[model samples]
Target: MTTSPTTTTLDAVLAGLMRRYSERVPDVQKVLDVMLDAGVIQSPDEIENDHIAFRTMGVPNLGLGSFEKIFLHLGYERRDEYNFVEKKLSAYWYSPPRPDLPRIFASELRVNELSADAQRIIHRYTDTVTSDPVDSLDLDDANAVDQFLHQPLWKTPTLADYQTLLNESEYAAWVIYNRYYLNHFTISVHNLKPGYNTIDEFVAFLQARGLRLNSAGGIIKVSPDGDLRQASTVAQMIDAEFADGAIFRIAGSYVEFAERRVLSPFQDLPADQITRQHRREGFETSNADKIFESTFTTQTGK
Candidate 1:
């Protein structure tokens, strides 16, 4: 089948993101391989990405404001905002101009909310990357987006600083280490075949294949209305070297699976009609809050 122009452009963008994501988190490639080999997904194109998420530090000229410019230039419009006070995170979801493209979910840590000591430690590194790195790129260029996703904006942290941040917030430690790397890419399980249609079934499939999951909110976080269900693999740990020449295993990126239900208005309609209707879109604060735990040391066993 001849691919549409939009599909062609989206394919290039997704490929670029995946290439950078897989470089640091090799498990992502492994997971995709397993799904394909198991016949869970006929091909890479068959597995639709519901969205791609990024975690950033909420400092001057950083975080969502800076990170989002690239996507905005690519035709994404910002949507709802969510606050996770406990996690010290504020996130927003961006809708793609085209329905076939995946949504964008970017979250930033509210650094000011951290203790004075933690904030100082974070600033020591973030201050090094003075300007918004994304500003230097031409968002209209696909290669620019690809390079921006993988570029390290800040210098590496020392073991002391890393431990300090980890003691207060794992999220901060993660950002300091993996600067601007794609945090996670979610697979839209709703698009999969019958046996793997639901989050439960898909989770079971992965479990059976020996992949560990983040059980923060019972492995599957569902919205109060039961329309959105989500789960994620516990982040895999990899050796990370600190400035002091000591290597420690730290939490890396993970993969997520999402299944969104049709809206209540279309729930009672015929299957075909429901499929044609607009499905419930956007992120759930509570569900996403738990999904963020996928990178915690407790969940990842780092």
Candidate 2:
């Protein structure tokens, strides 16, 4: 817990992950180091133990899958998603044992956005509902929340209970955060809603303006609300011209699925900021992008 800057390889390794000097990265990296010392073999185990999958020693808010991708970069290949199912979720390995299973910052963030559909449902029906309690609703992503709210999600709570949960619970935090996530469309404003007209108009807007859909990889709806929101999957981005999350004016324009505000692969440190390398460093996979690509290549059945 007390990692002194002097005489600590763990500290040096962690410093590399936090090269950008991110506060979130350090706390999460610290968590990962503890887990490593405790003999956590796979990233998911670390997540199960402490509700985090840090790319570095101290950051927990980044996606667990991102760190897994880092493992692939090192060639510490594990079973596929099917293996996760086949082994009851125990198959895992790491590549380049130094950085082990962590990173200093977040990843490319276009695909991971909150869906408008989720916002429409959770916020729209928050009041006047008695059976499904808003607090009990799964609120990590808009799509999942949408799915959960479709039926009597909360065993029939009273309106008061719904309000209480909405006021003081993780569900509320999720919805409020999603509202923030959905607001980040730096592109042209074609529509403010997700209806037939809005979706169509937005699609036209992206095309007419010649805007690209972040990376080729589109979307992954964590909730039912995300059923409509999509971009390209990592593989789709690599192999196909269009993606599952979007029809490119074919089916529909991409909508947010993963939370957007998080850091992503498409982004990089700003131009003017000096890295000011730490006296020490966090051992990381220099070729993380290559590893990222491999995960998609191997998984897409290509």
Candidate 3:
């Protein structure tokens, strides 16, 4: 099959995100290493990436409106919207142009819904972005898009501002410091070899390997219908430099594992005949709510 220009560009953009994400989040390589040692896969590429996520601050000329444009231009279709009321977050999942590509789960903080002082702390940094940065990008240029995704959208935030936001919304503090960096890339566990193919088995493998699992709701988050099961590693901490070069160790990024069980109608199909379409689709709000805390001090402080 011939890959279109849009798909090629999308490939490069995803590659850039994963490369840097793996470098910053040690758990990425750690997970891959354990999988390799356990014969779960022959190489890292053999793993199916279910999806990748990004965090953003909801403010003028930014947030989902601006961020979604990049992927939408690459042929990704916007799926469902999810609201995290308590966290003051709104997110949407985007289906990939090709099944081989990972889906996108992007969320933005509801800056306006935050406390007056918290909003002030966020706007102080985000206000610098007077225009939607994506509007300036030539989406066809893979290199430019890759660079834009990694470049700073605003000035480096001060430790004080970050701390204040953290007290209000950890999501806000994350966006202020992390910007558009990939929050996480999930591994599709359903397709793995037998013993490692289910979320329970996979979580057990990871726990045995000494990897810390996020226990916000439980080590494994199951949807109400029980078709989608998910789990994540507690976000690894990074020594981050704040404005004026004050260094502090804070939550970075984490790896997630998902198992999309075959829908009831497709349960009788032969294993080999089952594809992504035969399984449960989309994300669960309740499962995602706790998954968001993978980076919170509540989890990272553990």
Best by lDDT: 3
By TM-score rank, best first, the candidates go 3, 1, 2
Which lDDT tens digits does candidate 1 get at residues 1-302? 57654445556777888776778776687778888988988788787789889999999989899988877876789999999999999999998877767898999999999999999998988888778888887665666677767777777899889999999999999999988777899888888888988898998988988888999988999999898999998998889998899999998889999999878777687666554136878989999999999999888863
Estimate the Cα RMSD of every predicted model relative to the unseen true structure.
2.5, 21.6, 0.7
The lDDT ranking, best first, is: 3, 1, 2
Q: What is the C-alpha lDDT of each candidate?
A: 0.85, 0.26, 0.93
Clashes of each: 0, 42, 0
lDDT of 1: 0.85
- Give lDDT tens digits, candidate 3, residues 1-302: 89899989999999998998988899999999999998999999899999999998889999999999999999999999999999989999999988888999999888889899988877888888888889989999999999999999999999988888888888888889999999999999998999999999999999998999999999999999999999999999999899988998889999999999999998899999999999999999999999999999999998
Candidate 3 clashing pairs, residues 3+ apart or interchain: none
lDDT (Cα) of model 3: 0.93
lDDT of 2 by residue, 8-70 (tens): 433333333233222322223433353345343245232311001111101122222433443
